[model samples]
Target chain A: MSALLQVRGLSRHYGQRIGCEDVSFDLHPGELLCVVGESGSGKSTLLSTVAAQLAPSAGTVRYRQRDGEWLELGTLSEADRRRLAREEWGFVTQNPRDGLRLNVSAGANVAERLMALGMRNYSQLRGIARSWLERVEIDAARIDDAPTSFSGGMQQRLQIARTLVTQPRLVFMDEPTAGLDVSVQARILDLLRGLVNELGLAAVMVTHDLAVARLLAARTIVMQGGRVVETGLTDQILDDPQHPYTQLLVSSVLTT
Target chain B: MTPSYNFAFLDEDTKRMLRRALLKAVAIPGYQVPFGSREMPLPYGWGTGGIQVTAALLGRDDILKVIDQGADDTTNAVNIRRFFARVAGVETTEHTVDASLIQTRHRIPETPLREDQILVFQVPEPEPLRTLEPREAETRTLHALADYGLMHVKLYEDIAQYGHIATSYDYPVLVDDRFLTSPSPIPKFDNPKLDRSPALMLFGAGREKRLYAIPPYTKVESLAFDDHPFEIQRWEHRCELCGSAESYLDEVIVDDRGSRMFVCSDTDFCGDRRAEAQA
Candidate 1:
């Protein structure tokens, strides 16, 4: 398959501070890539810059539109960018509240993206939302409940459901399993794995957890100090210590 | 410094500026053109936008009418009419059909407007997406892009929760299939009249500092899901005074025993019907 996204020399800077610099990557259809780094690393900054949520100070992020045309994402008009974000891509923030509409019901959260894509059938919207909730391992009975009523794991699952309901070509997920309990995290990870494989979705996930990258991603990127330190197969990087940062990241994980 | 303002209370330069914006509004059909909205003698919410629009359009030959909640004698409407009379020295009429310019607060007149007339709406909040999205900057970007997903989701959520869109007043509409605009606080019943209108319709939001217009014969659609089409409110009771079943009615508390009566909200229309019945 042709490359879904192409990022070349992408960088984002906040004044004199470096957010992400000299980052280049290509994502194919149905491929899951993970960006792993420490707290101060530019993992999320790189993701946000590619997602167009944050403005980049330098370099270019090229996106292949659904119409077989590749365009520089940096130069797109605000309207075109918003439309592309709604139709072609999705962003899952780390905090579920940032990704989900807190006041609206769970069903509406999943249905909002469909509405943005111009789905006007009320019955169909509700039906798809209900199925997605079930797919996310959420009971359909709680569909009408607001996000406030849901637990942290349930809210995060709902956010995932909402993002994937659009069937976007690419999804940007920031630490999807970062805040959940171990058991809930395992369940969510399994559900996400099933959806990603079944839907043939291309995803760029950011997490500091090596285990998360091992379970979900095929390719992994290691970053330190706002730059890519290592890139390889997930198993290869996690099994062998290549770079000093990658060694520290792999060795720190306690294999019980 | 007590200085006399020009004709209709605005200076020629400001009027010219307003007229230029008004022309652009007509040209674009539903797009909100940003203008330097002037503060009127009235406060922000009391139809200041409508007053400014009327002041810009008023001339010696134009007959003006003002109504609040469809009543010419309502306190706010009466004040506006008195102010226009004192300042512009123009003739005022309560009859909807006779007036060349009608500035309304909430309800559109029952009388079908003529092609020669203009309807100026007193808009408190002009941006339809403001209720769904709180951020002004975000809403402006959405407007610029004609992205109305927030509104659709809000209405669709109403259906998912309540089985119908619960919005009765200030129902959102798409003007010329381009901009989603607020029809002020007018009930959804008046929304149908906005489509293919013979009269030129101008909307002014003084506090929000925006002005918009809908030219004659432009389409105005109420935002709704496909399975759940847009609908207006209906009542089982006919007008108690005019005995008309078709007119929009307002409920009035008649007694201390919790009694109420449904009467025509458009006072002039009700009065004319009553006069005709008596004759």
Candidate 2:
């Protein structure tokens, strides 16, 4: 099968300091890849560069359009890039507050992307928003409630529903479950697993938790000091790690 | 005429600069064009923008009319009219049909504007997305991209909360199907008059230092959903004085006991109707 996205020697530098160096990967349709690293290991930087949020200092990121055309992400105009971000792609921030419009109702938050793409019928938008809310385990009755009134886990779920309402081809998640409780994290992971499978979405997730990689990601890229130290199947990387950094990450997981 | 100040209280150079911005604003229908806003003798909120626009456009032969909330004799309207008469020495009239230039605040005239007339709107806040998105830089980018999802979200919130789009005034509109323009706080009842109108409509915000326009025959569509379509406010009580059911009405309290009566908000329209009936 052909890859949906291709990153070739992608490098981002903060002047004299390296953010992420020589990160290359091929993400296929329906593939879920996790970038596992410690703090300041360039996982977030790589994610941002790949998502076109931050301009890479060097290298090319190519995305295959729905019409079977390969588009050079760097070459796209700002308008074009913003259009792509709104219409075809989605970003789920680490904080639900960052992703969801807190002042607006839950329905409006979920329906915003559709409205952006010219969906004018309010009832139709509300209906779609309702279904997505149910899909994300948010009660349809609370559609009019503000995200500010929601609990942390509910807010995260609402963020997921908002991002997925447009049925985006690719989604970038930055530590989606980082701050959630263990029980809440497991539920969110389960919901994400079902969604990724049902929607056939390609996702690049950045997380420091190895258990989360095992739970949701099919493939894992281990990073250390702004470099990919190991890349393999999530099970293989956790079972028999090749790199010393990968070995430490796998060993660090406390199995109670 | 006294020649101490230049024509219309602004110097020739400043008028030329304002004319340039006004021309650009008219050229790009509904797109807000930034301009150098001069401090008028009046305070910022008291129709400074509309006064500047009228001053720039007023000629010696023009008849000017100023209205505040559709009333021609209010403090704001009277002061502005007096200001123009003193500075420009132009003929001023209260009749909407007789005026060549009409500077308005908060309402459009009940009488239909003709091809020869020009309508200048005094805008307090020019950006339609200002309330939704606060950052000026981000709002500019959104306008450039025609990304008005925030506007729809606002409408959606209104519907979800109030069971309808509850925004009564300053409703956002897509002008000429391109720029999302604010119709300068005019009631949504007057929104239909903006579409395909024969007269040119210019908007100016003195505090904001921005100007925008809707050329004759331009499309001005209020933002709405197909299900929850754009709607205007309706009045159950007709004008008690003029007995006109079609005009925008203001409720006037008769006594301290809260006895009130509905009257035509447009004083000129009401007076004209009364005169016609008497005739």
- Going through the candidates in order, their DockQ values are 0.84, 0.88
Query: In model 1, where do residues sit more than 4 Å from their true spots?
Result: B1-5
lDDT of each: 0.91, 0.94
Reference contacts recovered by each candidate, as fractions? 0.86, 0.89
Best by TM-score: 2
Model 1 per-residue lDDT tens digits across residues A1-256: 7898999888999889999999999999899999999998999999999988888888888888778899888998888888888988888888999999887899999999998878899899999999999999899999889989999999999999999999988999999889889999999999989999998889999999989899999999999999999998999999886999899988888878
TM-scores, each model vs. reference = 0.96, 0.98
Q: Encode model 2's per-residue lDDT on A1-256: one tens digit a residue.
A: 9999999999999999999999999999999999999999999999999999999999999999899899999999999899889988999999999998888899999999999999999999999999999999989999999899999999999999999889999999999999999999999999999999999999999999999999999999999889999998999999999998899888988989
Model 1 vs. true fold: TM:
0.96
What does the lDDT read for residue B270 in candidate 1? 99
Docking class of predicted structure 1: high
* Model 2 C-alpha lDDT per residue in residues B1-279, reported as the tens digit of each score: 456777799988888888999999999999999989998999998888888889899999999999999999999999999887888889999999999999999999999999999999999999999987889999999999889888999999999999999999999999999999999988899999999999999999999999999999999899999988888888999899889999888999999999999999999999999999899
